[model samples]
Target: MLAYIGKRLMQSVITLLVIITIVFLLLRLLPEEGYLGAAAEKMTPEQQEVYLTNLGLRDPILVQLGNFYSNLAQGDLGKSITYRTDVPVVEIIADKILYSLFFGLGAVVLALLIGVPLGILMAQMKGRWLDRLGTGYIVFVVAVPAMVYYLLIQVYVTDFFRLPMLFDEDRPISWILPLISLALGPIASYAMWMRRYMVDELNKDYIQLARAKGVRERTLMFRHVMRNAFIPMAQYLPATILFTITGSIYIESLYSIPGMGGLLVDAIQRQDNAVVQGLVLIFSSLGIIGLFLGDIVMSLVDPRIKLGRGESVR
Candidate 1:
């Protein structure tokens, strides 16, 4: 297990380096004006050269990359150029991350609480009205473009619930819409996967033998089917939960929430290259970390699934 963890950690670091390098090079391809900001228009040619020189932008790409890595090793993520000129990227993200964290955690908890139960019920009630209703909801959520439903909820649901259409930090009621919007997709995902896994478990040979031995249906479903089915689901929970906590870009933007998602959007619109780069790196690292943790969680949940051994129960 330790070996597996070390291997995964090393792979994650290499992947992160590759992503960072690609993003850095791509950002360089963008017009240098992105680094100079609106002030680029005001500066004389010599002044622009001087400014770029001070930023080390005039350095060779390899040298700049080396410098970036050195600073990264020390926990400096550079500074915002356009969005909040000269502000440290880390500080900018710090200001916004808490909002995303609060709403994202709320959304995930809401999703798991509602979705898991809905899925269990749907699986148990297969071929019945309840199952059909749940299936319809899953289909609707999967088939519809997210933007359409997001707007509809913002308009109609807000009207019906007498809730604010946009998020307001001080007004708890206003938080409802964004949380609901953020949770909807995850709820559908969790419900669909849980129902599928449970249904699969129900048809397995062990479940059949248990049924033949006169195990109560409820007991069999929960104790045997759900327990085994949840092992596979555990593998994905960490990644899903982590990604959700990173914030939903569209939902945050639509609800006007001041969060990491919206911050990225604003940075892009302002062409704040440093901020964008920093956020992208953070997001990439989180995704890799989530996946790494998911693997460890899966092994812990099901001891038969051995890591670094090329063997798994399923």
Candidate 2:
């Protein structure tokens, strides 16, 4: 297990390095001769060179990449170019991560709260009204893109109900609607997968044995069935978290929330290479961390499946 974990950690490091390299290369490839495309038209060549140099855009791409790696090795993420201050990149991300978390975490929790029970209900009530209702709900949500629902609720539906707008509220729970919309796809997916898994588990001889032994239906489902059946889905949580973060782009934009996803859009609009690169690195790191977390969690859940790096249980 220890060896497996060590191997996975090395792989994570390698993956992160590759991600940074790709993003650095992309920024270098952007068509700009030292901020030449900026909105400022009065800049002299020397001034432009200084500004770009300061942003490390003037260095050879390879040299700049090496420097970036060096700084990162020293735990220094470069400052924002557009923001034009000494604020640490990580600090900036930390400050705004809460909003994304508010939505992302809420969505995940909601999906689990709704999805797992639905799965169990569908399995136990297979071929009955309950199963049909569960299937219908999943199908309807899956058929409609989340963006459509977000708009529908924010526009026509909410207006009709005369409910306070999410963004208009003082509390972040006002974000609940958008968060639900963001989570809808994953919730739909979970229902489909978990229901099938639960059905399979229920059909197993072990389940029949338990039922024959007079176990309560609820205990049989939750204590034995759901726990074992949901293991595969547990492996999926990290990726789902990443998807939620990326999906936040549209949701945040629609809601006018000032989170990283919306900030990414602003960076692109301004051709702010540093902002774009910084965000890419930040999000990529988050993704890598999520992957690591998933692996560790899975290893913990099933010790037979040890980490790649052979590290002891975290």
Candidate 3:
């Protein structure tokens, strides 16, 4: 297990370096004008040269990339180009990432708490009213665009309940609507997947064998069926948890949550290369790490599964 973990960690580092290189090269391909927004546009030619030169934009691409990695090794993510020019990119992200993380964390917890039980109930009560209800909810959430729900919540729920529409740091109640919007789709997804997998598990030979052995119904349902059925679902757990840090673009925008989503949008809109590159690097790293961690979790959850060789015990 330790060897497997060490191998995965090494692979993750290599993958991150490759991602950073790709992003750096892509950002370099953009025209010099791309980095200059309205704020930079007002500067005279000499002043602009001075600014770009100071940013090392005048350097060769290879040199710039080298410098970027060097600074990255030292924990410098560069200053924002369009936002707070004096503020480091990491500092800006640090200030806002927590709000998004909390919102995402809340949404995931809500989805798991509600979705898994709902799925188990649906599976246990197959073809009944509970199953139909769960199926309907999955369909409804899948068919509707998330934007519509966000709009509805902002327009009706806020007005009817007299709750704040926009997020306020000091006002915790403002979090409710955004959290709901974010959780809605995930809840449907988790419930539907859990139900489908559980149904499959219920029909397996082990279930029949367990029944023949006179295991209690509850034990059969949870201890046997649930544990086996959840292996596939467990693979997604780490990624879902890590995504809280990335935040939902739509929900953050709708709630004005001052999270990573909004910051990314603003950075792209203003062509803040430094901010954009920094954010992309962070996101890419998280995505890679999340997948690696998910695999580790899946292995741990099911002792039959082996990581390095991709082998499993029957």
Candidate 4:
């Protein structure tokens, strides 16, 4: 198990390195000649060189890449060229990542809170009206696009309650809409899928044995059926998490929320190659981290997933 975990760790590191290197090369290859603009053009050539130097743009490509990795190894993400304010990339990511995390996690958890038990009930009541109602909800959730749902909430719910658009000056409104937007897809998917599979699990011999032992319906559902059901759902977590992350760019854009999504969008519009590269690296890392954590948790629950040496679920 330890060996398996160690192997996965090494692979994740290599994958991250490759991604960062590709981003570096792509940024250097782009046609833009180092962030030319009204502000940049105002500087004399000497001043421009000095300005670029301060941002580490003066170094050779290889040296710059080396320095980036070296600093990154020491937990220092380089300063943004576009922000031009000597703000570290990690610091920026730290601020925005929490928002992304808030939205992604809040949505997924809420979806599961509602979707899972509903799926279970539907599965148990298969062919009944409640099952049909649950299935209808699953379909309804899938039919509506997240953007449209977000627009509806922004217009009707916000307007009706006369509530503030977002939570505060810095944070968005309890991150509720963004969370729901990210969650609905997975929630719908999980309900339809888990319902079918969990029903099958409940029909198995082990479940029947548990039921025959006078186990209450709730106990049978929570203790026996849930564990079996979770193993399958656990496999979905990595993909579900990545999907939520990718969708946030769209959600944040729709809401005008400032996050990594907005940062990336702004960087692209302004042709700020440095910030663009930095943001992509950070976002990619977030996905990888989620996958890694999911694998660790899966290992704990099942103990069959071994990814490296000297690594365990604990």
Best by TM-score: 1
Number of clashing pairs, model 1? 0
Instruction: Please list the residue runs of candidate 1 whose C-alpha ends up more than 4 Å from where it truly belongs after superposition.
Output: none
lDDT per residue as tens, model 3, 1-314: 77788988998999989988998898778777766667566898888888789889999989999999999999999998778776899999999878777888889999999998899899999999999999999998999887987798799999999999999989888888888889888789889989999999999998999899999999899888888878989988888767755758778887888988898888887778889888888788878888988888888888878766645521
Candidate with top lDDT is: 1
Q: Please, what are the lDDT tens digits per residue for candidate 4 over residues 1-314?
A: 66666777888889988998998877777644456545676788788777667666668989989987888789776666565545777777677777676677777788778778788888889999999998887887778776777778777877886755554545445456566667778778878888988888888998888778888988888887877778767766876776576558877776766677877887777667667777777777767777776767776677665445345333
Mark the regions of model 3 whose C-alpha exceeds 4 Å error after superposition: 39-41
RMSD to the true structure for each prediction, in A, is: 1.3, 3.4, 2.1, 4.1
| Candidate 1 global lDDT | 0.89
True-structure lDDT of candidate 4: 0.73
**Which sections of candidate 4 miss by over 4 Å?**
41-60, 166-175, 208-219, 238-247, 303-314
User: Between candidates 3 and 4, which one is better according to lDDT?
Assistant: 3
TM-score of each: 0.97, 0.86, 0.92, 0.79
Instruction: Give the least accurate 10-residue stretch of model 4, judged by summed lDDT.
Output: 305-314
RMSD of 1: 1.3
Ranking by lDDT, best first?
1, 3, 2, 4
> Distance from true position, residue 252, model 2, in Å?
1.2
